[model samples]
Target: MGFDFLEWLNLAARWLHLITGIAWIGSSFYFVWLDNNLERPGSDAEAAGVSGQLWSVHGGGFYHNQKYPVGPGQLPRNLHWFKYEAYFTWLSGFSLLVLVYYVGARSFLIDPAKAALEVDDATALGITSLIVSWLFYHNACRLLARWPLALGIVWFGYLVGAAAFLESVFASRGAYLHVGAIIGTAMVGNVFFVIIPNQRKVVAAIKAGEAVDPKLGAQGKQRSVHNNYMTLPVLLIMISHHYPMTYGAQRPWLVLALLGATGIAIRHIFNVRHRNGPTGRWIALAVVLALVSVTYVSMEKSGAPAAQASVDPDAISFADVQPIIEQHCTSCHAEQPTSELFSEPPLGLKLENFEEVHAASTKVKQMAVDSDAMPLGNMTGMTDEERATLGAWIDAGDPE
Candidate 1:
């Protein structure tokens, strides 16, 4: 197999992104769970400035953790900061975005069917949208600091609106990916611009033997809470490239909104579960219901009708379909793709033969016919009639 430098670069960046993302999310989850499970301290611990504490057993050992509402009288000798994970995650992720979308804007970023944009224009729009989103979120946090729930609802609406707007201007895949990128940018920005800076102020004050400003800690905690809630949704967006149904729908923005709500609700259940919150079960049920609704709607909108014209599978021979595949798909899905971006067939699914076509009938229908996600930005200009023929062939059970 040949090697593509760009593809290797993407793999390296994606690997780091996943690793750092896991570290960052794992820490956030542990802290949130610890906060919820802490119990009020005893008199002695209270005298020592401990507001709450928790005891747990893990790995055949007991673990005790204590929380100080403010800073302790003295700083600990060793303090490990959690900021690098967030930083690296954003850095690696942004690297991947530039490599995949910006560099290959013509094939992966712009959709002529959506909007007539030059490659430069689409890349500019994607970059600008991320910056604008961060500015809006930062301002919203400061202005609506007192009403977090309200701020969350309003921001959620902003995201939905952004998705709607982007889907109109970008390729469906690129649009969904941008939404995810926006959220990732905000999460890291919260850490870099707000959470870490506020935390530093609190620490500096504590180190200098001055009373720490309570607002600094409060602001940091608020952003931390927001980050925790956003974790699940961001994960969904990161992996959305592989799933066509979520981004390929007629109203992909609506699909994103519903799926996002489901993720938040699921996260909420976990956030409260340790505290024996009564709403966990209810939220889980909501997630199940929301998923069902999304699945039903997606299938209703994209799945071929039962009455679609039938074809005689025997008549639909490999000879009839070879030209279409060669023209539209073989560029990237061949043993040695002519496309420089791919060193080998994408997903190892070569389409050079009838056997390969028959083997991938299901994927062909899903991506090309049903979702219009294949040909990666319609680079090959696969016609409507071609899609119709492929669909009929697949529906007839891919006979010989």
Candidate 2:
């Protein structure tokens, strides 16, 4: 068999992205938990510049962790940095984005129904969004440094607006992924531009026997906390493509906003709980937000009805819809896909025959009928009428 270079390259980048993302997010969560759980240091330890400490047992060994408010009295000969994980994660993730979305823009990024963007324009827009998002977030942080509550509200509003704008231009899945990429960029920017630089300054000061600036430590802590809160939302966006119900909804941007809010609220509950704070109210809020998101996405929209009410269920049959499937779906869903996008049927679904199509009736109804999520960017130009016909067939129990 011949080698598939692009496929292997895509897999390698995705694998690296997953590995580094875990490392980066794991460290962020651990540090946040450790900081919240730390107890005040004893008098002697405080005198030696230790602010807080924690003791824990793991793998039959005990470990004690210490935090210095500014910098330790003396810099350690060897210090560990958590920057590379964030850097490499961003690199690999951007590589996958370019490989899967930009390179295959016609098949994955552009939706003619949304915007008739050429390949070059779509790729440029995606790249520009990343840069512009980071600039806006960074500047907002600096502008509202003294008022954290205002900064958070503004940031959340900006994200919602971005989701709406992206959904208007790019394909729904592409829009959702770009939102995730934007947030990820801001997170890594915090580590590279804010947190690490502040640490290095403090280290230099301590080594030179100069007093460290307290603001530097406070700034780093603020950004770290922000990263911790954002982790859950970004995680959900990463795997969202597999479940079309989210990005396929009538108002996909609203669904994204509501779900993102749910994730943030849930993340807040853990942060509050870790600090030994009462989490009853936050937990309640999170539950409510989650239910709202689920309900909103489940609602049927006007254009994309669940089934065609005018069509007689008894009249539609497998024979009537077989031609529609052949025209719009078989290219990618058959046992031997003719589409260049896949060597095998996507998700291992082969719908060239009645049995296979019937078995996947629900998925077809969801992706093709209820939402324009299939045909990958509407590459085969599947029509609204055709989708309704498919919906009617499935509703009629997919009669043969």
The per-residue C-alpha lDDT of model 1 at residue 144 equals 96
lDDT of 2: 0.91
| Per-residue alpha-carbon lDDT of candidate 2 for residues 278-366, written as tens digits (9 for 90 to 100) | 99999999999999988776654644445453456679788889999999999999878899988878889989989999999999988
Model 1 lDDT at residue 71: 75
- Model 1 misplaced regions, further than 4 Å: 302-314
Quick one: how many clashes does candidate 1 have? 0
